[model samples]
Target chain A: MRITCPHCGERDHREFYYKGHALALERPSPDAGEAAWDDYVHQRENPAGVTRDLWYHEGGCGAWVVVSRNTLTHEVLGTQAASEARA
Target chain B: MGNLVAKSPCKGLLPLSVGAMSASEVETGAMTMLSPRKGQDGALDEAMRAVHGLGYPAPSGVESAGEARAIWFGHSSVLLVGAEPGQRLEEHGVLVDQSDAWAVVRLDGPGAEDVLARLVPVDVRLCAFPVGSTARSKIGHMSGSVTRVGEASFWLMVFRSMAETLVHDLKSAMEAVAARG
Candidate 1:
């Protein structure tokens, strides 16, 4: 897997570490119920199709990237800086 | 500051000359890491320009004016080498002293690229890396900041704690490249 870091350009996948789903960036509200918090904290959907995930470019640009990829084929569709994704 | 005795992180192991390539520790007088405060990039740029006659470099690029060189490290951050020590841009963002945090080394010679290709995964070819281009990349399992300072020279900065490891890795790679010649 190759990643095109926005800052560092294209680099090998060994430079990055998959940090799970991009949804992890959204946290549950402080006053939300236990079930809501539990679902937010522990629940994960094993979608085999296109999924948006987060990856850390630890060895490259140190940028948190949101990668759009297919879980089944492992084909990366696209990527963008996570900060820009949040914006 | 006058009481502090400067020390090279690589000690006496650097300034190595081997075959067509040579490696030496670079004495960067003063260095600072600058990060613009949220929504204050314009202000930071203006201030930096006033100080150094140049603004922060673009991604993977370098900007220099007089004795100061600004190399882009990541988004909205730059490493300013030769910046006046104790200088601060408090109103614009954060300024931290980085002179003692990194080990700066220079590798130059016709075969410098050959040696680097054996270690780093980045494309160090003259056409790819070009002079003034910089990148944060890994060198033998260690994170490092690499910048092309000249047509045949590169400056590499790694954590101070990893200086010895970097020297070992560089020597091994240089030796292998020389042996193959």
Candidate 2:
């Protein structure tokens, strides 16, 4: 998939790194205890079709990007900052 | 070594720390990372814009932290050339010391564009890929970004581990182009 890094020009997909899931996991507040943060850190729905994923351009600038893609085809639907996606 | 083989474009002098490596036959070159303050988009952008405004064409893409054209070398690193003179990191973003962690290479030659054509899907024809533009795509299974540096020269950012693989493919492609001629 060709990603036009708002910073670097499109090169090859190998330049960037794949960081799964762009949406930050929500954990219960401090009082929520271990189960909360544990689920947040370890659990992920690995859904197919349309999904929000985190991808880091490890090969390029190394920015964490929130990219929406199709799990089946690996087609990148759109990409933005992970922070913006949550908002 | 004291004299800048190529004067610093933005800074009056290339830091003594700044140096370049040349590709044996492919006319390729590499420069170690320097002053790449990661996340410090403000400083990076300001400096790069200053350089661009000074007249050299720098088209930055990272806008959030004010970084416009400088190439993001990787997650925490970026090509400083994209930043300009007045830019500084204190105001915004973060800088990571990525020196020795990765390698930088310049790819150019008479048939450089033709060579890239075999690897990248982007249009490498002079009229399309023209200088100053960049894109993130793939060269085989390896992913990276390509930045136009000169008439036949381009900046290719890849992981250090992949440097040998990339250079080999690039040199092979160049040879193939020459063979086709």
Candidate 3:
């Protein structure tokens, strides 16, 4: 698979590291309670359709990117820099 | 203190040639990494233009003025090569000396693109990656930078410690490409 990095253009998937869901960026506050913290730490939704996930461009630009992809078709819908992506 | 003589990272390991292609170590006088502070991109560009007669390069771009060149180094960063950065540049961004941290090799001659094709995944053809284009990509499992400096010349850089590996990989690719001729 090829990911088109916002800054580095298209690159091979080997250069990127998959970092699970993009929701990982939405961390709960320190005193948000056990359930919230537990969900934040361990809960994941394995949706079959479109999903937004985080990826690190470890070999190229070293930027965290949020990739919008379809789990069923493996088609990459879009990609944006993690910093610019809205939670 | 004992006398300490400086040694090049690719000492005795480069200046290799295989058929039409040659790989040689480049004496990068001073390499300074420029990363603009938040909201300081314009100021940094102005400072660079005033001090070095060059502006901040765009992503995957390279700007050159005389012997000095600035290569886009990853996101929000540029590597200034062959020039001593002025003190004014520090006010707008962070300037880190990277002269000793990278091993730069100049790959020149015919089939230079073919040699790099065996290593990097990026499409390095002149039509796709023209002169003055640069990219931070992997070179044979090692993350490195590739810049098209001329029609048939490319500048490749990796960490200083990987000089031998870089040379070895380039030599092997060079031989393989030449053998196909």
Q: Candidates' DockQ values?
A: 0.80, 0.40, 0.86
The candidate scoring highest on TM-score is: 3
Off by over 4 Å in 2: A1-19, A23-28, A41-43, A46-49, A70-76, B1-44, B47-77, B81-106, B120-122, B134-145, B156-167
Indicate whether candidate 1 or candidate 3 has the larger TM-score. Answer: 3
User: Can you write out model 2's per-residue Cα lDDT over B101-140, one digit (the tens) per residue?
Assistant: 3434566666777778888766766687666666555664
Worst 10 residues of 3 chain B by lDDT: B14-23
Give candidates' CA RMSD values in order.
Answer: 2.1, 8.5, 1.2
| Candidate 2 TM-score on chain B | 0.58
lDDT of each model, Cα atoms only? 0.88, 0.54, 0.94
Models sorted by DockQ, best on top? 3, 1, 2
Q: List model 1 lDDT by residue over A17-51, tens digit each.
A: 98999986787789989999999988998898999
TM-score of each prediction? 0.95, 0.58, 0.97
Interface RMSD of each: 1.0, 4.5, 0.6
Q: Which candidate achieves the best DockQ against the true structure? A: 3
lDDT of 1 by residue, B102-172 (tens): 99999998889998898788998999999999988998889889999999999998999999999999999
Off by over 4 Å in 1: B1-5, B85-88
| Candidate 3 lDDT over residue span B7-99, tens digit each | 999999989988988999899899999999999999999999999999999999999999999999998889999999999999999999999
On a 0 to 100 scale, what is the lDDT of residue B19 in model 1?
Answer: 92
Per prediction, the TM-score for chain B is: 0.93, 0.58, 0.98
